[model samples]
Target chain A: MFFHIILERNLQLHPRYFGPHLRDKLVSKLIHDVEGTCSGRHGFVVAVTAVENIGKGLIRDGTGYVTFPVKYQCVVFRPFKGEILESVVTMVNKMGFFAEAGPVQIFVSNHLIPDDMAFQAGDVPCYETSDGSVRIQKDSEVRLKIVGTRVDATEIFCIGTIKDDFLGLTGDPGGAA
Target chain B: MASTGGEEEDASELKLGEDFLKAKCLMNAEVALILEKKFETLQQLSEDASSQFSQVFEKSLQYVKRFSRYQNPEAVKQVREVLSRNQLAEFEVCVIGNLCPETVEEAKALVPSIAKKDRMDDEQIEQMLADLATIKKYE
Candidate 1:
């Protein structure tokens, strides 16, 4: 007569039984452990298990535990910090003007225009040149003031003005075209 | 023969122990591999997130630069109203003269009414104007 006992432990006996969900859980746990152990370490590791069962009486005789090989791969990444840049305007309107500098876009508001400068109602920052030419344009350069920044959601709002002497038009007034 | 059977049993037990060790090693390896894959995926996500953050920062900076031009308190509505039309004209002269008394005297001379209302005597006005000229020369 033969008696069989199913002695189960935390250990897995076969690799085929390891599913994606379990693998994911194991990976997350490992990462947490690694991160906790090391301060400011930039990456994490993943583990894969493969189990094989070799026979009949092995289960009944307290010999169920077997060893298997595991594969490892490292994943690394460093957090990013944004870049600051200057932009030039390509167009203007009553609401604002469009500007481009590097890979970013910029806007200058009507309120930001100098008080001495004339702004026609409904003209969207339109003005007349000294030689009788009417030009509706935004200044090429503007100084930007950051009001708020959101990193997780990736959003930024900035207030722009041209009132500063250093931030607006440059050179002799006659040379402006 | 009984001894031989005992020896076989002993061998079987040893084999089972080795199997158990092998299984444990395999499990550890699997866990490591899974964790590595997860790390890779998370890493990619973080990179993408960081890139987006950078773009937002740049855009925000541009807006700040543009809005900074209008930050002057002197340009607000109530302040402008208080200056009045005449005050604005006088302010313009003051600005042109670089806030010198000579410029104020010139303005008074040009606008006789201001000179009379301000009660500025001719002698006082002359002295203020001369001092302003001297200041202007040094500037």
Candidate 2:
């Protein structure tokens, strides 16, 4: 889910980005610098919602750079250990498969997949039933539940499972040819 | 299906949670999925109060292995809300709500063994059937 969190950042503005459009430059720069980035304290900063307060700017002596302590509200996404998420399958290997739900990468081990589905090696690696009725391959959208999550300052790694009901491939029943 | 001595049927189960606790509780990989949400909620509380619930929490993790899939929490919440509104028993609601039978017969199948022994009335059965119809939306 998304959460509104207050985050403070010391934004350094280049002297060129000062003057008439100084605030505009700061706001745009804040979005470019913070959005899509992850912090240990606040998960993933989805967006720089609003600049709550822009404190007094201090000009550096030699660089002519202005440092502004900007307090802002942002929407953050942090997956809990048991949260269910839908993601698109990105890779397949003997160990398991990797999926991406926005910036979060989920890994579903073959051990956690349904016993009925098996791995098949070919031009495109995939998990499939012996009958070829259900297949999971690259680009497949799947519903998985997080069992473990490791959030780093830059990215989140999750161990997910699709072994439960209603938590597997969401698209058409197997476009297997 | 034959415990039919209606009148003196162990009044204790009527109080709360006893009948459901007594039901042999066989949930295969396909059906036990209804327990995932409850397990998740319990697990969260356990983490918050770590020592207090450690035993039960550990037991539940072992129990969850029987149900292969960890179901969608949103779907589980939606079904539970509807079941509670229909006035079903709390403990049993977790079982039936998660099983999420799509039809009256399907719903009936879940409790028939216990229903026979308990002599569950026609009205309670009807309410459950109706609840299932509404629960289908979540599935």
lDDT top scorer: 2
DockQ (CA atoms), all models: 0.02, 0.02
lDDT of 2 by residue, B90-134 (tens): 434544543444454544444333265654556766666575565
Which parts of model 1 are misplaced by more than 4 Å? A1-85, A120-152, A170-177, B1-139
Tens digit per residue, CA lDDT, model 1, B55-115: 3223333333332222233322222233232332322222223212234554443333335
Global Cα lDDT for candidate 2: 0.59
**Top model by DockQ, which number?**
2
For each model in turn, which proportion of the native inter-chain contacts is also found? 0.02, 0.00
| Highest-TM-score candidate | 2
**lDDT at position B109, candidate 2:** 45
